[model samples]
Target: MILGWRKRRIARHAGKKNPPGNQEMELVIPNHFRCPISLELMKDPVTLSSGITYDRESIETWLEAGNFTCPVTNSMLRSFDQIPNHTLRKMIQDWCVEKQNYGVERIPTPRTPVTPIEVSEILFDVSASSLDVDQYRCLELVQKIQKWGAESERNRRCIVANGAAAVLAAAFDAFSNDSVERNVAVLEEILSALNWMFPFDVEAQKSLGSRASLGCMIWFLSSKDLSPKQDSIVALKELLACDQKLVEKLSDFEGVNEMLVEFVKKQICPTITKASIMVIFYMVSVAYSSSEKIKLAFVKMGLVSLLLEILVDSEKSICERALGVLCGLCSCKEGREEAQSNALTVPVMVKKILRVSDLATEYSISTISELCKYGRRDEGKILVEALQVGAFQKLLLVIQVGCGDKTKEKATELLKLLNPYRAGLECIESVDFKNLKRSF
Candidate 1:
């Protein structure tokens, strides 16, 4: 009887079985089986040199975040190596299996982390395969690099550190001259790999900014596939930021500015839109004399109208960038005329002032100042429109809220320009001018 009673007690303690249509009881995990960092059941348990066990991912993350010491003990690590705690992992797996009725599942075995030597071997294969001679082999190797890059941040860093970016860029430059139609698959794959390897090393960036690479990017931008186009624009944005020389070369590409402006006009996606705008901004903002040519090209392409449209209903960040580009474009006579011709220009500029941000306000006021200051035939009309759009009131708000000295100076100048027209317009009430503490 005592033996039977002991068996009953063991069954009762294991878990209480629920009746039909009832919720299952929660499983209680042992504290020792939990990782200290994640406070959850350990999947792939690993031991540090400090004698503490943690989940492999958790420990890797801790170290990756620049924490050299042990998380729980706060002691300096003697070695960076993490030894697998296979024994503990097995125990956790068994426990999970036993709790299968309670919705617990066993963790799959973790894959081995990629090492630098493995990345180097693949890169060597890539360099060996010629796109013209061994197209199949080249595609496979580039795809493998892309796969490894997608697996983990560690893998990406390892791949990049081993100079995968420069190798892939060189491969891309070599294949760039080929007909993109026949080799679209290989070219797209190469672009995908290169795109994944963003924040490239300076050498890699320079290679990307080469003439062949720039031409290749333009072709991708005009491609039917949205994915490659998105990737290409993002890559272009990064390249333009790193290399000023790329600006001049980029303008030389046929229909490049038109493609960039079309991307903005279509509003393909916010990421692509912002990147396209920034590329245009960089192209025109170059200190070199080619910038003037690029600016005129963009203005001829109706960029001012596109920007005015964007300012109508964009978010704060887009507004700021668009306004910045507008400011640059307005520095030239054609850009000022284009902006002045757009019915939305003065009203949008007024709406943006003191509303979006300090920078937006500054750009808005600066663009208006350019039109009013340098515009050929419609200077008075622009000032009158500024007055009509409640720009006068917004300028006062800008001065009252306080802004940078430059912005304030621009606002004061605009006030002086619009002050004469304020009394003539019906929109300007005496109360609007009552708050002024100083003359414009």
Candidate 2:
């Protein structure tokens, strides 16, 4: 009994020495041995089973931050389910009243720094461990962070930025091997922190670096390797829906849009590893976007023509990717086909395929020959005329080198139909039949 009285007395008198607004006031604690939620003597002084509790505002500073365990039970609490213990709440309120009557003034403390070290320390705490934060505590951390803003000591802003990256990396690592809905929460937090860090420091959003970070996160979230539980799907969809804030940020970030345009227009190729597909998809379909700059960037980079030309590349994967993008464009609301036509899309594709057929592997020769055979029908005679001028001879040369029986059979059939002999005789005096026979 005496010990409790002495503790209260100490708390009360300690408040006096600090005085209001004194620098020393920052360290003072309220004079109470009570829980904020339950008004009574905190029996176990434990955090509730649900991971949150309401306490009298007076005893708020007394609780250890990010700790959710009931001081009494010591049982692990899940964050989302925490409910306030009102009885303990009332007791603390009563104590505050008594302290007020006794002329004890409360000294309010500013929030602690949110530096890397602080974030690291907090992560090991129980509350974050349980993945829960009550409203008041969240507000407190925000206030604290805001108070410490820009001018914060100990290089706090950078700490928060790096700390956020660490947390995001941890979340990604956790889900790297297994797909889980929990990944969404962690991803969202990472994105939020990235946003926070950007305004706080420009380096936080490195043009290439942030793109890579987000690219990785998006890849993991949409990874086909993972189970892709329903929740994960929903979460990914939500993220893709639209980010007004990100759009605004991009508008102000100077080079972000241009960087994105460059990546989309010139960087992606089908030869890229499988793990990178989702990122490519997201960048094309979501991130790089449909803005005029992006559209013009593609045009400026000659992507439209290059993409069509690449469709006939000897590399199957590269051809497939280019084809896929073309197919996707055909299905869009944009007059992609119209643009292609106006921009010499058909002529370019036909010309490239014809040329590829002349020098490509037999497999490529067969595919391009078949495409050319059927393509000129829909694409027109101009394309076929382009192919007849000894181009078929070059194609036969390639076919002879690598063509399997089936490929040779197809090439023969195409040759019968294309008959470059007459055109070859008329155009070039000497026929390169030696090389052509070698291909055959």
Candidate 3:
């Protein structure tokens, strides 16, 4: 708009006096050439259901930000569907040529979006491996597909619908069999592609949790490569998330539990940290209830101190998952001892209640209960530590707040158990356990 005004001012003052507040006139950028969202010349203009044109990149960004209203019209967006403005694109190209003095360059035509059939054909290129070069070309194409799909939700669904999961796994297996450096690069790309597609492959998620596929993931996690190892754990987390039985079988894969602990202790990547926590969540989902050996495995890994360290300043999700894993590991005698070894364990648990979530409060209460109930020689000290750390006050607070009934009943029990240790505290005077009793 400023440029347009300046151009008019220059035309009106042709061979005459300069207009007030005007030093130099600039080229006026045409309104049609500008994208409403970016206010810049449109490269690949596409129209939405609101009959508004925008550069494909700008409009897609708007949609991805969860906006359902048109940026230009402020009306409801009828649909996310976009049609390419071929005529407008041609005009923009010609205008760029005419405006060469202004350093404008013609934009190249965008490639057609990758289709499901194209992904299937690329999988065939991977599977028909008469030579390593064929597999390499397929790897490059898979990378291209991943790039395109990540840019827009439409292409991501298209790639997933055409069985990108199985193709990626095939690429992993085929290239993994070869030791060539080129094949190593191919294998890295395959791992990445698999990680990107694994979460969306509904049918393939279950199938990929099979024993053989689980073994392949375990092998990757055991490797020394920092990059693929991170992707492997993330993919493993996606798989075990839907398959509880596979989680229970984590011990069935030798050294899987230990690898997860080492990854957590190293604190390599944030995603790795989150993925490791999730994997352990499923691992102990059922094992904590039925298997003492599983509890022993986690304790022996020093998971207690590890969790205590993360619970200090971790995010809510990570804090909750850590509490869950702690609740499970604290089931056995070994687990209790490991937790007791860490001085901050009691204090951290006492602090987490009413801070993270209702479920976190439950897990925190359960963990403290296990420590108080199962601590052989440390039970008395645990109660004293709880009182010293103000667990009594928090327990009363939990009962007074909107936590679940079961949580209230548990908190009441824990408080009653600790009452003898607190001889002079007003926080416990108002505590009433009459209505908080468990029916069962």
| TM-score per candidate | 0.84, 0.29, 0.74
* lDDT per residue as tens, model 1, 341-396: 88999888887776667788888889999998898489889888888878887787
Report the Cα lDDT for candidate 1.
0.81
Report the lDDT of model 1 for residue 177.
61
What is candidate 3's local distance difference test score? 0.75
Q: How many steric clashes between backbone atoms does each model show?
A: 0, 26, 0
- Decide which is better by TM-score, 1 or 3: 1
Q: What tens-digit string does per-residue lDDT give for candidate 2 at 1-440? A: 11122123234556544334442221223435534445434422323444445332322333335554544455555542334454554555455456553444332322333445666564344134324423234334433443444444334444564444344334333333233343444443333333334332222223213433344444534444433222222222233333323332333334433433344344343222221222222333433445434444434544455555445433544444444444333333232433334434433443333233333233333334434454544333423543544446554553546546765676676666656434534232133443333322
> CA lDDT of 379 in candidate 3?
79
Q: Tens digit of lDDT per residue, candidate 3, span 293-386? A: 7667888778888899989999997898889988888877788888888998988998887677879989999889888777758877888888
lDDT of 3 at 168: 67
Model 1 RMSD in Å is 6.7
Instruction: Give the alpha-carbon lDDT of every model.
Output: 0.81, 0.40, 0.75
Superior candidate under lDDT, 1 versus 3: 1
TM-score for candidate 3, residues paired by index: 0.74
For candidate 2, what is the TM-score? 0.29
* Comparison by TM-score, 2 against 3, better one: 3
